[model samples]
Each structure stands twice: as C-alpha cells, then as structure tokens.
Target: MSMTSILLTILGIAIFVVGLLFSIAWHELGHLSTAKLFGIRVPQYMVGFGPTIWSRKKGDTEYGIKAIPAGGYIRMIGMFPPGADGRVEARSTSPWRSMIEDARSAAFEELEEGDEKRLFYTRKPWKRVIVMFAGPFMNLILAVAIFLGVAMTFGFQTQTTDVAGVQKCVISQSEKRETCKESDPVSPAQAAGLKVGDKIVAFNGQKIDEWSVLSDRIRDTIGPATITVQRDGQEKTLHAVLKKNAVLKKDSDGEVIPGKYVSAGYLGFAAQTEIVPLSFGDSVVRMGDMIENGVDSIIALPSKIPALWDAAFSDGERAADSPVGVVGAARIGGEVMNLDVPAQNQVAMMLFVLATFNLSLFLFNMLPLLPLDGGHIAGALWEALRRNVARIFKRPDPGPFDVAKLMPVAYVVAGVFICFTLLVLVADVVNPVKIS
Candidate 1:
C-alpha cells in the first residue's frame, strides 16, 4: 500500500479503538456518577475488562485499567448478589460510617449479608436500578452528541431520493461537452438499445424517481423484466435482466427488519444530488429519532436471530458476506473511505454506522442476563422484590445474589460469549468482509 493508504488504514483502526474506549468509558462514568450521587459505595472504577493493567486506591474507590478493550465497569459493594452476609452492627453504628472501612476489618462478614460500605444493597432499590440503567442511557446521549457535533461542524447533507443523472461507460474524447455524446454504437446501454438522456419512467411497473428504487426493484425481480422508459419522446419497453452481484457482509439492521441488504448491481449508472444542510433543530430531532428507531429495531431482532445467524454461518453463497472480527470492520472502513464521494462524507457515513453500533451495544446490554448491565439490573430488581416480600411476610430478609446458585449460569454465559467471539474471529479470518 502507498504511504497515504497505510496512514489512512492505521488512522481508521486507531480512531475505532479510541472511539470504542471513549464510548465505553463514558458509559461506565454514568453509572459511577449516579452511584456516588445516591451515596452508594463504588469500590472500583475500571476501564476495559479482563485483568487489571493498573490500579490504585483513590479515597473510597480504586481506579484502574483492565486488559480487555471491550468495555469498562464500576464495582459497587451492594450491587452484586444481594444477600451478602455483612450486616450493619445490629447493636448500633452510625449510618455515616464507611462500609468499606468496616468490611476490610470484619473477618466474620458473610458474602450474602450486605456490606455497609460500598455495598449496593444499602441504597434504595430504585437507586440501584438507575445506576445500572444509566450506562446505556449515557451511550445514547453520547451518540446524540457526536451526531450533533458533526452536523453543526459540517452542515448535514440533504440526500435526495431523485435520480439526477446516471453512470454509463464511455470512451474519452478530445472535445468538451455538457453531456455524454457517444460515437461508439455498441456500448452496453446502446447495445441494450438504451439512449443517453433517457428518462426512466418505471421498472416492473413501479414508478422510479431515484436510482435506488430502480436498483432495489431490479434485485428483487432478478430475471428479465419489462423496463418501460421514455427515450426521445417515445415510450419503449426494454427487456432487461438484472445480474446478480456478490453477496457482501450483512448489516445488523437486517436482523431487525427483514430484507435490509443492499447488494451491488452493474446497472452501468451513477447519480448525484444537490447537497443541503439540515437545520440545527431538525438535525437534533433526527438524531433522536435514529436512537428511537434503533431501540425498537433491537427489540425486534431476537425473532430474526435464528435466520440471521444461519445466514452468517452456513457455508453457502450468502456466507461470503459474514465478517468475523475487527479486521472486517477495518476492511469495510477502508473501502468506505475510498468511495468516489468526498472523504469527509465517507467519514460521516462511518460515524453514522458507529452510532448504530453504539446503539446495538446499548440495547444488547439492556437485556436482562448475567454479566451485562441488563443482567445486573434484573438481579438487583429480583433481590429487591424478594426482600420486600419477606418483609411483608414478617420473615427474615433473604441474602444478596447467591453466587453459588449463579456460578453455573455465569459459566454458561462466559462460555457462550467466548465461543461467539472465536467464531466471529474465525469468520473474519476466512471470509473477511472487504469492499470493492
């Protein structure tokens, strides 16, 4: 690769890493801030996952970095399995006393009884839930901020759905001209009996304003179809058969809404539109709408996971599009950067994709399961309810989340996550998603 190409490639990967870290840190910070606000003890605030790279005690919390770049988290005392054995001195101790200080010294403290310091359970259940949910909410806010910042800096382009022009191959000429004037009579469009300046009236009887509509219709139709067009003030029917293009990587949107893929087609055409900038208010609203749509789509994606996963893994023509890892993201990013459009515009498109990626992270973590934010939320909620019901029955309050009972589930979840990551890595290695 050329120096500039190498630079862009490195730059893309670097930006992606930085972006993921920034996004993840901001998410964890939200949880930390809320927990502190509610007077809950957060013993550790770490960025990244896995083993700690660096750590130090800072007042009530230990701040550190972990080896895993996937995400970051805050460890609050009471938030884990609710029934930790540490009890407040039943005899009488000031609520103002630090729970961490006491837990450090108390040898008899049980894991299920709540710890006074840094324990998440001592705080109100509602507060605990808020802390867990805040991470995803923070992510949504970050996306909005990034989108708005980009929009404000460069007026958002107003892309039209209209076909202003078309791309057709032609021989280079010596004379300047306003439009294509072909001397050759046997070009593809000409051989297909298509003429320059021909206005496309319809494809498969569907009205075509933009090339995208025609492209999509043609892909769906697949075979020779009657294409009606107005050329030289005459309506002509061209028997056109759409050719199949390579199946590229599938997009996440396809998992939510059926039939979301946009395959390549050699229609021998290109088009451009008048760029328009969105108003600041409109841009903000549009960004919000994007988030809303993202949430709804994520909620609906589970039903299609079986089909989507099948497509992703099956060793068939469609499997060619299944990308497995960070390499795939880089390959795709490089291709996007090399689009015929402006580089800044390409970056903007990448940012939009990143926004969707962030949105997926938010929604996926919100599902109630072990290890994810949603899982913690579910665990906390269940603990709170159990405690409340026990209080109503005039019985002893149950302990925090039972680690012994949950260990099996945790192992299962961890195994699945690892397997999926490995599968994706393999797929990325073997069938890396690259753009042409």
Candidate 2:
C-alpha cells in the first residue's frame, strides 16, 4: 500500500483509541465528581480494567491507571463484594466490623454509623437520580460542543452550484474510432429541455462560464429550481424539482444496497458538484439539528437492536447491512480523512458520527442488564427503593449484593454483548460500507 494510505490507517486507529479513551474517562469523571459532591467515600478511582500500573493518592481517593484499556470504575466504600486486598478491612478496628465495612456493603447494608461520609445513600431521591444520570448527560454535552465547533470552523458540504475555474463538464474524447457515446446522464440538461445534441448554455439568468457555476446554483437551491438553458437556437426557462438523490452501492456480487448517503439533487441528469460557502450561523444551526437528530436516533436504537441482530445473523437480505465494530469504525474514519475536503469538514463529519456513537453508548449503558452502565443505575435505584419500603415497614435494610441472583443474568448479558461485537466485526470486514 502507498505511504499515504498506511498513514491514514494508522492515524485513524490512533484517533479512534484517543476518542474512545477520552469519552470513557469523561463518563467516569461525571460519576466520580457527583459521588464526591455527595460526600461519598471513594477510595479508588481507576481508568480501564485489569491490574493497576500506576497510582497516586489524592486526599481520600487513590487515583490510578490500570493495565487494561477497555473500561474504568470508581471504588466507593461499602459497594460490591468484600475485597481481600485489605484496603478497607485492614483499616477496620474489628474483623467482623471490617467485613461489614466492605465496599459492596455500601449498596445494600443500611448505615448504623458513619452515615455522614456515605452521603450518596443519604441524599434525596432526586439528587441520587441526577447523580446516576450525570454520566450520560456529560457525554451528550460533549457531543454537542464537538459538533458545533467543527461545523463553525469548517461549515458543511453541499451539492450546490458555486463554480470555480475547474472542469464541471468536459467533452469526452475518443482515441479509437471517430465516435464516442456519453454514458453519464444529464439530469439538469434533460429537465431544462436541452437535448442530447445541445451543449452551449446559460444558467439562472446568468452567463455560464463553466459547469462549476451551474453546479453552485443547484446546490444553493434545494427546493424548487429554475434553469435557463439554450436549446436548438433559443434560450428557455424550465421549472424543476431539485430533490437530493441517494447514491446506491453494490455488494461483492454487484447487487445495489443502501450505503453511505450524500445529498445530490436529481434534475433528471447526473452531474458533478461544486462547493458552496455557508454562513456561520447557518452552519451552527445545522450542527445543532444534527446533534438533536443523533440523540433521537440513539434513543430509538435499543428497541431495534433485537431486529437488527436477527437481520445480521438470519437468512435475510438485510443481514449483510449490519452495524460495525471498532475495525469498521476505524475504516470509516480513514475513508472520511481521505476525502477531498477541508480538515474542519472531515472533523465535523467524524464528530457527527461520534456524537451518535456516544449517545448510543449513553442509552445502551442505561439498560438494566449486567456489565452495562444501566445495570449499575438500576441496582442503585432498586436498592434505594427497597430500603425506603423497608423503612416504611420499620424493618432493616438488606445485607449485601447477592452475586448469585445477579450473576446468572450478568453472565448471559455479557455473553450477548461479546457475541454481538464479534458478529459485527465480521460483518464490517466482509461488507464494508463505502462512502461515495
């Protein structure tokens, strides 16, 4: 492969990792900060999984870096199963009290003493809910800011007619025989009553110097369009609809399938596009709308996950057109980087995808299943409610997080996520989505 291609691939992978790490860290920070604000005793703040490679003591919390790069966690006292590491137990006055003071107990055991430091459990219901929800909220805000900044800096690409002194339309030359045929269709020409033989033209009541000028006008006008072209010996104005056409892709077997989409007006003919400048305010508004749409789409994805998985694994026509994994996302990022557009535009497009991605993660993590953010949120909420109900009856809080009760479901959910990730990885490699 060429050096440029290699460079792009490497860059894409690096960017993907950086973005993922940053996003994950930001998410955990949300939880850490909120827990601290509530006066909860968080002894260990870790990024990623596996063994700790480095650590630093910061007040009551021991912040550390881990060996694994997948995900991170916050170690709040009295939460989860008792650790044999003696981090909490050794510090306790009595062995029995140490067992009771374990990290996991924070979620289940009602505080008999030291209630002041365990403020997460003591806070009002709304405060607790907000803390649980803050992580996803931070992600959403990050997405919006990234998108808006990228848009303002680069603006958006549109298939409009704002021509430069470049080849918009060129006469095809033949070397073999004396004759050559035009394979590309002219949508605008046909719509404007220009025949196969008619070539010279003026557009939008202005003299057309090149095809670029014509392209600019069409892009600027996406709704109703009017084109003035020379036909035979006279000029005429033809009313047309400038609806964006979907660019189709073919699979390895040469079958057309839905793929990366672009906005191109269908004037009943095929033509190249030109770049058009957008106002800063307009770009920002578009970016905001895009972020809103992304959030809406993410909120709707979970209900569709089962169907999507079925389509990918079953004998359905749409099975091949499934979601992608890390490899696929990197490939896509590389392709976007290779585009003949400004860096800002490229970043904007990537940010758009990332926004939707983060939003998807935010919603997905909220599901009340094992190993996901949603599971933790659900566990916390359930414990809170259970305690409140027991208090009304004048009973004591529950004792511990029953691993047996939760393990079965957690194992199943973890299996499903792993399987899905592998399946999507295979699909991404086999049927990579190519942007036209």
Number of the top-ranking candidate, with lDDT as the measure:
1
Clashes of each: 32, 22
Report residue 183 deviation for candidate 2 (angstroms).
15
Model 1 ranges off by over 4 Å: 50-57, 81-115, 151-162, 165-275, 279-327, 334-341, 384-404
Q: Mind giving the per-residue lDDT tens digits that candidate 1 earns over 386-416?
A: 9899999988977564422354465578787
What's the lDDT for all of these models? 0.62, 0.59
In terms of lDDT, model 1 sits at: 0.62
Question: lDDT (0-100) at residue 218 of candidate 2?
Answer: 52
For residues 300-390, write the lDDT of model 2, one tens digit per residue: 6556466555555564333332465667777777787777767766776677667656765576667677666566567667767787888
What is the C-alpha RMSD, rounded to one decimal, of candidate 2? 9.7
* C-alpha lDDT of candidate 2 relative to the true structure: 0.59
